[model samples]
Target: MKKIKNVRTVALDGLNAIENNQAYSNLLLNSLIEKNKLPQKDIPLLTEIIYGTLQRKLTLDYYLSFFLKGKKKIDDWVQNLLRLSLYQMVYLDRIPDRAVLFEAVEIAKARGHRGIASMVNGTLRNIQRNGLPEIEEIKDPIERISVKTSTPKWLVKRLSNQYGIEVAEQIFLEQLKPAKQTARVNVNKATVENVLELLQKDGLEVTKGEIVPESIQVIKGNIAHSHVFKQGLYTIQDESSMLVAKALDINEGEMVLDSCAAPGGKSTHIAEMLSNTGKVISLDLHEHKVKLIEGQASRLGLTNVETKVMDARKVGEHFQAETFDKILVDAPCTGFGVIRRKPEIKYSKTDKDVHSLATIQKEILQAVAPLLKRGGLLVYSTCTVDQEENSNVIYDFLQQTCDFIKDDTLASRMPEKVAAHVDNGELQILPQYFQSDGFYISALRKKV
Candidate 1:
């Protein structure tokens, strides 16, 4: 108990990074783990507590606000300590409330004075006695969805307006916490069956991904830092994201382009699918990001990938029309679909931001359209659910562009589990619906 508390205190350093250093949760958390050299067994608990509190910040505050009595005041460290404690109390049944409260008091005492410790003790005891406050009482629909799902009100309003109230509420609710560690098995190194064997050998309960045939969801494993990941036996990717490579349908020796590829999860997947025989030109907006694709390619032992820095929105002037066998416009967007994986996104984004990103989506799609060969395939995708960034742009592009047609077999690569969403020349995946990030993809073919 004492050791775990010490580790929790260490994690607070990353929380400080999140607040003052402008660090991402994943990057910050990983850095803290490396620097502190925390034991592997504690990673699950530390990660759960950190991500859970961040994911449900608004909901936690809403419940805790009731415990604030007599013009109550609390310092930042006390608030953060209470947030972590309350998250454990409400979400983790294994940890007793007494233990949680004890840890909270200890953390409060270390970072603050006796006055703050007493308040922390009183507030946690009140929650233990009264239970979680009723979030159902929030009258405003936007605020209700926001608090219930722990998303920001602005995001709630935008999603409600975009995808009717019912679906929007469902999406937000699903985004609160979800299965985000889906990965694709590297068949070149080991078959899915063999990979499952290896994971099971390590006492990890793994399952085949529901949507993509080659994708696997590690239900009970932390092989990310283990030899499996380091040796490049598997790549972490959502099952829905794995669908993009299949949708592209690139054959070996074909020339392909991933115009907005950076982190190269999709680019390397394409190389693997083509049996490492095709040319995958990976272009991103920044030179520094090319190393990510290069690293992944090297780890996966994929030599087919070529990384460059070029904005897809301006690539028309550089690449000739119909020059490549396939082109991917993984356009940047509002990223609404990935909120479950990146809960902070809901708070960081605004309503106006969606439309601004939509303009970029349209521009990138339009510019990349001319670079596709007359008979080539173009697969447009985003980690967002907004229609303005999904169906709308493709609708407008087909009307204005020449020699493009919706390819019917594009959805055929998706497993039957996601067949229902396969519609109208495009298929969309919801976060919880597929137990993956919310992603949308539309496939188009340049006519001969």
Candidate 2:
């Protein structure tokens, strides 16, 4: 029998896998699209449905509770199907409610029994007729934002506490927008102007980055599949990520250490900054991920990057003290800043995780402190907007070490548009500010 391979079915399966923590949404969705050979047109719709379903899951459940009142225990898949359908009916204006309902019923029938199909049909129809409950009715402000934004209440509370309610709401809403694909021009391989023209010639709607000269935002088409990428003319990276390497300001013949470097975006960029003349020793705890740095270095034709499989916390032990001219600690965090790209992170992380990550980040910084040359630079960065993992970690680190002080040169390195955000030495970029991922970057210089 031919398999029922609808876009919604694929989304439902992906949603179940993400909710079960089996795989991340982006990787799983791409894998399914390629494995099933889903139509190119359906790719956008499928991605929207999966991300939308996950992003608005809390809000969907809130509305679902009213409809499912007095009902028996529901299977997880059925619930996921209903959530997927409700996400479309509620958020996606292009997809008609009737079409969404029909597709949901068909998918339920294929995946479950007739009884489940009837429940889906009846529930969705009832939602269409009666509409969802008002979010205003939710009493608690945190819970209200949580449901309305489909963000975890704990996160909502944390953001609100850190940056008042208005900014928190801004951050919450920003995550709902679909993430745009951006890439950095491998200036070593090709000039930015040349790369942009080539990307345009390849039919990509490209635009210059607002914050970085080396970045071009792809308005349409997949740059990864383009012939230009195969030639290593550009690399697919977020605009914020490109800034971390720039903050390091490595000169030719300098030696740099990228602690926690994997999938080597910043590490390779550091190599590119040196005109491929300096060495960038990239380290990651996992040997498998270390290959990613090697692969990226090879792709960009950068000979300066050397990959090593070792814990970032053991850098001092691996290398002699004051050996590196500069170091980058792109520490791992809760990933709160990148919710637009990975909606599942908001649900999986907690306050405890943030503090715990800060601990590890501090350890990495402490261990690598002795490895940097006197007067050398160290850049700390994360994909998250969380204060604890960013400035707090640095502040705590500074209190312990007298050899390092905040490097204010970071402001001069930034584009004029963002120069104002760099205060003293730390910067937190909200995703909405640049229409990019939320990021935090800070720079410190080792004293003589």
Off by over 4 Å in 2: 1-4
Query: Per-residue lDDT for 211-245 in model 2, tens only?
Result: 78888888888898998988878889998888888
- The list of candidate 1 runs beyond 4 A from truth reads 1-5, 69-74
Which candidate comes out best when scored by lDDT? Answer: 2
Q: Report the alpha-carbon TM-score of model 2 versus the true structure.
A: 0.98
lDDT of each: 0.82, 0.89
Among all windows of 10 consecutive residues in model 2, the one with the lowest summed lDDT is 1-10
What lDDT tens digits, residue by residue, belong to model 1 across residues 1-448?
3343466686566555665566688777787787777888888788888788888888888888888866457566667777788889999999888888887788888888888888889888988887876778878878888888888887777778887888898898788765557789888888888888878887888887766777777777676866778888889987778888888987889999999998999999999988889799999998789999999999999999998888888787788776789999888887888877666777777768878888888888888877778778899999998888888888988888867999887657667777667896698887768667889988898898
